[model samples]
Target: MSAHVRTPGWFTVNVLNRAVAWTARRGISVWGSRVLAVRGRTSGQWRTTPVNVLTVDGQQYLVAPRGHVQWTRNMRAAGGGELRLGRRVEVFSATEVADDDKAPLLRAYLRRWKAEVGVFFHGVGPESSDEELRRIAPDHPVFRITVTN
Candidate 1:
């Protein structure tokens, strides 16, 4: 059998996510919060969840700190999705970063969201070595977002 990534359970889904999604829907970004909507690979229906959209340098990214979750898989299959913050919705194409190219983005993501999702990264933090981050890159999927306008 193939290895599967761990997904969030009870409290994260029912409580934390509900609160985050509520705030994001109002355009009050709680640390770059946005609703990621992607079409399900099989169902073809839009599935949404609150996400942290990280902007590093001049580029925007979607980092899956929760590991290979459904959204990540859907994004891979769909090639694009929408990021909704209140009434503002941005349609964008996503390119999955290769494992070797993920170190910096992963580091930045941890620096910003470590308090919330650090447990999924084992013990690696923003201060961890590039080699260390590279080692765990496969577990987490990083997508580069390019606005389609």
Candidate 2:
């Protein structure tokens, strides 16, 4: 794959995603980390992607439902970027959290997502419990983005 895809799919995020981000900004939904808009590493275009965020002991972390994809790719590409929390902006560093820590981080995710998160855990049969999915995919990567502080 070339550095930049340049396809429409690569250029934009759909409305549903925008809504999640908006709600997060408004504190209406715990779904997005407000919005982490990273500059495209190659294209230099700004790309805003929704990510579920958590403040662990005052340090910030974000984890995606998807194991590895565009949003994650964008995060990896930038290494980090500006994180918008309400009216405040802070620089952040992106680190892919180790697999062994996925459980605790995912626990934070489950708390925030509740019923809304099932679709992402597709591997778990609808009847399967969260515990089941946790057991099955305990090694999935959870990316953590923390403020440079």
Among these predictions, the greatest lDDT belongs to 1
lDDT by residue (tens digit), candidate 2, 64-142: 6645556667777888877665666668888987655556666666666646554555545334555764563433446
Candidate 1 residue runs with Cα over 4 Å from true position: 1-4
Assess the local accuracy of residue 115 in candidate 2 as a C-alpha lDDT between 0 and 100.
Answer: 67
Worst 10 residues of 1 by lDDT: 1-10
lDDT of 1 at 79: 96
TM-score of 1: 0.96
Residue-wise lDDT of candidate 1 within 55-103, one digit each (tens)? 9999999998877888998999999999999999999999998989999
Q: Using Cα atoms with residue i matched to residue i, what is each candidate's TM-score against the true structure?
A: 0.96, 0.68
Q: How many collisions per candidate?
A: 0, 0
The CA lDDT at 37 in model 2 is: 75
